[model samples]
Target chain A: MGEENVMSDDILVIAEHDGSNVVDVTFEMLSAARELAKDSGGKVLAAMAGGAALAGSLGAFDRVYLIDDPAVSNYSPEAFEKAFTHVVRDVDPGLVLTSTSTMGLDLAGGLSVAWPAPLVSYVVGLGREGDDVVATSQIYGGKLLAEVVVDSPHAICALIAGSFSGQPSPEAGSPDVETVSLEGIGPSRTSALAVHEPDSGGVDITAADILVSVGRGIGSKENLEIIEELAEALGAPLAASRPVTDQGWLSKPHQVGKSGKKVKPRAYLAFGISGAPEHLEGMRDSELIIACNTDPDAPIFDVAHYGTTVDLFDLVPELTECIQA
Target chain B: MVLLKQLPDLVEELEPSPDGTDIDREFIKFILNEFDDQALEEALVTKESSGAEVIVVALDEPEVDQVLYTALAKGADRAVKLTGVPAGTWVPTHLRAAILAPFVRELAPDLVLTGVQSAEDLDGQLASLLGGYLDLPHAAVVVGLEVKDSIARVVQELGSGRSVEEQITLPAVLGIQAASQAPRYAPISKIRQAMQAGGLEELEAPAPVDSADIAIAQVRIRRLYAPEKSTHAEMLTGDPGEVATRIAEILRSKGLVKA
Candidate 1:
């Protein structure tokens, strides 16, 4: 369980890879880690779980650990748990940080169970606490913010994807790369199939610059044609709350919310959405939000930049015609 | 069958910060999450098919008894309030599993069910974390379930638009999705019976685990504010061509169209 060079208090950030590429959240977590490392006088280490040549691509960290094994070919909770458990033991980091992605949540949950230390997920803000680190997390579906103090010598937390916008790296970008072997550590159960990306290419809404969204108030499937035109006119992709996707007017890939993709687009034009708590959870990070709905009292209007009480069916067509002109 | 914790009244009016940051209350009211209602619905269906006695349970203030009463009104054969657990404290999924384990083990239900995540906590870690603590087969975001013999086949939603079917031996934990099944409303007659039955057992609270290792370190308010309002669309009251010109201009300014 002991490694010769493991640092007991180094902050470990488990990097996330989209099978072939490292997700942007990796850098976001690194940015958060840089702050913690500075305060605690600890080093920030990036752990690449899987994928091709990613360990070399991430150059911002002081140390990079590549846990590449034939067994960890895909996103399996068991595989990640084994690899992360090894990393924690090997590195002996005081704090373990990861991006709160689908894989991250699963891995973090497993770590909490495997280790006696405290684990936090979906962290939006972080700072150092004398020797420990404090994190601000959005709980209760973005309705409230909780300040958590992770005092464990071995504390683990997952950073939310757009919590802190990425910052420029001032240090010369050369990091030491260490390839770790997963000889004995392996997943109990495997994915049993190839990893496939959908047609939308798993576009992250949180990172998009512009968004066009449809909601339940958008009315009927025929009405979707108007929003599609709007998206087409703007050259922006189409997104919707859960109801639109459930109706099959839009594919599940286009759904945005706590249950869907969390988007932080520069501009998000939401049409006909009721702004339910779960629906709002995903888009809480968008920079500019616009709501067009019949109900002036819609919860979405409470947080929107521009609000209209006119029926979307009437407004959408009129708006579409105006945009086309 | 699965247990869903009933929620206390929602305090939607509380906007502590004009910017929508920080909660004024030390603890918000408790209530069962909406998705958990769907889990209860799925359990009710399983009970109907197999004639199994489904027991719904919760750990909260007596205010939640009305929710359990509502569950019974919907068709749960039995409902009980789990005592011993403190209200308003952040209960990790593993701790909850530990508390529920002995009781669940004693009852020995064929399957365990709960809402995929709690509404109030929004941790979304319970079902999976509980499964780990129990060391049993578990699935999250289960969209479909079919039980035959002692085996349960479930359709689970993974990331992206993909889904997979997995079969588990009896006694599994499933974190249900809100879209998985439609939650049925409780009939008025059953609601009355559940409220009148009044013999719900309250269990003792489990020991509090020290969160010092995982305590809240510090909180930062990163631009907390209510969602902003969208700009009013300048209505184009003219023919299609004229409207199109205005639309194009707007789209162009928005960088959505060629100028």
Candidate 2:
């Protein structure tokens, strides 16, 4: 069999889920893949490695390669890799899309080396330029953008979370499902023991209409009280960038960023946050954004509808009073 | 137990070179990648808890020798540098992985650890690529790791603050996201002691991967540039009170606050 020459104009979306439900990034990958498909004249295929029930969530995909193996019920890296690789080899897709998240990173690189395909990660934008795959990746935590043109026909792209329309995939028609034969995928060397879910009943920032967020510029845990008052006055949830959560100034639930929750509140008030690309990826889609930081060049300004150079310390209490008044 | 890499520190201002293909490194200072530092700490923690040899390896780079020496002072058992690449030049991750594979195969290590990612390679490719080259199981964004009797129990972060725990067989690669504790410091005095001993080992570097092998296109950065600001924000001015008043007005106009 001429396996090496079997590459086709099909982009495979590796769908990820949390135990039972398919995560939003799966749809995002499908969305991005659909865009790529139009240019490459390819079919948007999907592969899921969990319970068959999860396949119901992948209706947007035309064909789903389901590896409904119990070993992949959770996120067992080896089993998932083996099953996904089977699809990649079987389909010989021109492109393979995976989210640049925990599960995606675990599989994408291994898949790349095993398949011998060119790999691109941190992908924010992807398009086909004739035979080449052009990817815009956020490097240096979003400080600079790199235009990587992969000359090869087969490429693996790990799209960063929030790179496209996340949930509510446009197409909802039932797709043809093919059960890939997992003949050789034996027990994996990696065993999934447990998943400690994030604490619930915390201020659900994702559901907040208005979000008052803070970041490293808040300086200390004590300074958080000032922002806390602003959030309370506006009756909005208090959110923070990763550093605030990392420093234990706020619990994990209050954090908003790539590694944190993706929030689209009606209003996003960012104070002291310099707007690392990670943080922006989470809150940039807010209906309205207002940012305040001491630095004029902070990337937060690039996305904010309204911005200021006023120190957060000098601005928050006054803002709180004005809101209350 | 871990690989430590030193690269241009992000704290320094990054400017694209005149050619626009890469960042200008001539004026930038270098520091150990933060994630790699965490990996080193995790290894040192593993060493203290279960008793394991921690060997820190890196490709030769400027100030990398000092970075390794500092690791030795902190607690690593040995330091290694693969020689032959141009000093401080940006090495493609594919080539870097390929170059390290031959040597990593030599070690026949039970466990290989590295930071989940460096700023330069956010894809977290090194661990997985090495796993592919060496044919070992791998995990990424691992926040906690505990090894006992050929089994490595790890807690991997899955964004949105959720995490899953897994038990990986030994002879595996792990991309550490953070350490259970902050990386320990190697007081300058101890660092001097490590340097006096001159323990950094130099291994024969393998020839770079064939250009033909790289034809699979290992992602050449065709260009790098500062992100152009597309939409400048309407910058509010005047006193803090004035700015706050404006913010309040906008919030109300957006129907974000109760009238």
The residue-by-residue lDDT of candidate 2 on B1-259, one tens digit each, is 6887777866567888888878888888889987888899999999999899999998888789899999999999999988887564576677777787777878888899998887677333688777877779999888889999899999998887788899998989999887887677889999999999999999878765453255334467788888888897899999999999999998888787784
Question: What TM-score, computed on C-alpha atoms, does each candidate reach?
Answer: 0.74, 0.89
Best by lDDT: 2
Off by over 4 Å in 2: A1-7, A166-171, A207-210, A218-237, A247-249, A310-325, B122-124, B185-198, B207-212, B215-218, B237-259
Q: What are the C-alpha RMSDs, in order, of all predicted structures?
A: 6.7, 3.4
DockQ of each: 0.19, 0.57
How many Å off is the CA of A296 in candidate 1? 8.4
Cα distance off (Å), candidate 2, residue A2: 15
What TM-score does model 2 achieve against the real structure? 0.89
